[model samples]
Target: MNVLLFGASGMIGQGVLRECLLDDRVESVVAVVRKPLGFTHPKLREVVHEDFTDFSSLAGEFKAVDACFFCLGISSARKSEEEYRRITYDYTLAAARALPSNPSLTFTYVSGEGTDSTESGRSMWARVKGRTENDLLAMPFHAYMFRPGYIQPLHGATSRTRAYRLLYVGVSWLYPLLRRVIPKHVTTTENLGRAMLAVAGAGGAGEHILYSPEINRLAAEGR
Candidate 1:
């Protein structure tokens, strides 16, 4: 199977790319980026395109993809609601519209915990994410939203956001405890990646949304 990956330079995308490259079932991986990712592998290909809002120029490259891992996201830190929606909702929808739709084609979206599916929530970011997830689900292609909380990066996976990286460093020691005590609330990058691959390949465990425990379970099944 072949795959299209967005945000391969980000934390979650990095882990997914690593898993896809290592998996024998994946024949190729096309990573969409604004610039070269500097990583090299036989199965990995990078497509540098600056515009995420308009995929018209890149339509030719977005065809017949068996799976798409949409990990592109940005923190809502200081941005206005419009700015955040542009990145979180508009960019995701543009890519989804560009991708070819099929029953066998799976699209995995990496949302975070507390995402409000109702789209009428108090949290601005969650509402945007909820709307994004809701629209993706309405599409013809198979779609799954992964809502991971406290993701412990494994195998050199690091966040592109400096603040998140610093926070990860500060709380790195609590990963083991969280995994043991609150497995449903915590999952490592490795497990999340494997779980995505599993669902994309097998089309299960994605009735609607997936939390951390379900992700770990799917990963174990895939393994």
Candidate 2:
């Protein structure tokens, strides 16, 4: 399976990329990045894109992919709702539009847990993610939205927030204990990444794959 990835430089993206690289089923990986990925592999191709809002120039590159894992995300630091929506909505739509050319495209989006697409106007981040999720679900291609909570990294912390870093370190040893008590809503970055790869290689049964505990359970069995 040929996979296209966006935001291959971010925390979750890095983990997902690693999983894709290791998987034998993945024939090739095309990364669309703002900066050069500086890696040489027979199955890897880096497409340096200048603008995220427009992919017209890179249409050909986006056309032949079997599946796409869009991990491009920004933190809700101090940005206003408009700025956040632009990044989360506008950018996602632009990239998703290219999937039509590859009719059997499976789109796996990295979405948060609290997202609500009813336009409830509650939390700005959730509302935005909800809207994005709603829109993507309406698209023609197959779509899967992963809503993971407290993603424990496979390696060192990558978040700039000191609180997140400390939490990662603290939970590094207690993950097994927490998994027994906590619901499967909380998952490791490794598991989530592998799940995405599985969905991409094996076409999801329906138009949308809303990954919850059951989906993760199935993914674990295959691994």
Candidate 3:
């Protein structure tokens, strides 16, 4: 299987990229990044794309991929709704439109836990993500929106945001306890990556969207 990935430098993207490399069933992995990740592997390929909103220049590279793991996300922070929407909705949709709309392609989008499907919510980020998820679902590929809450980065997957990194560091030891107690919402990066791979290889649990619990369950198939 050939896999296409976005946001390969981010927290979740790193994990997905790692799993794609480790999985023997996968033949190749392509990551579209703004800069090189300072890594090399026979099965790995990187395309430096400066503009996320315009993918027409790299149309050829998006072809013949069995799956795409799109983790290009950012905290809304103090930015205006338009700024957040540009990155969350516009950028994601550009990539989605660039990809082939085939049955063999499974597109896994990393939406957060509190995404507002109604697209008219109190939260700015949630509203944008919700609209993005809804639009992607309307696409032709076998798409799955992965809504993971409180992901514990594993196998060297680190967050680009300093606060998030510190938070993970502070609570790293509590992960085992958290997983056991609130298993439905919290999932490890390892499991998230494996789950997406499983979905690309085989049909998922008869569901287009997957929460943390379902992700963990599907990831177990790899083990």
Best by lDDT: 1
Q: Which scores better on TM-score, 2 or 3?
A: 3
Clash count, candidate 2? 0
- CA-only RMSD, every prediction: 1.1, 2.1, 1.2
> Which 10 consecutive residues of model 2 have the lowest summed lDDT?
206-215
Poorly placed runs, candidate 3 (over 4 Å): 203-205
Q: lDDT by residue for model 3 over 44-63, one digit each (tens)?
A: 99999999999998878888
State residue 46's C-alpha deviation in candidate 2, in Å: 1.3
Cα-based RMSD of candidate 1: 1.1
| lDDT (0 to 1) per candidate | 0.90, 0.78, 0.90
lDDT of 1 by residue, 125-188 (tens): 9999999999999898789999998899999999998999999999999888888898789988
Clashing pairs in 3: none
| Better by lDDT, candidate 3 or 2 | 3
lDDT sort, best first: 1, 3, 2
TM-scores for all candidates: the values are: 0.97, 0.90, 0.96
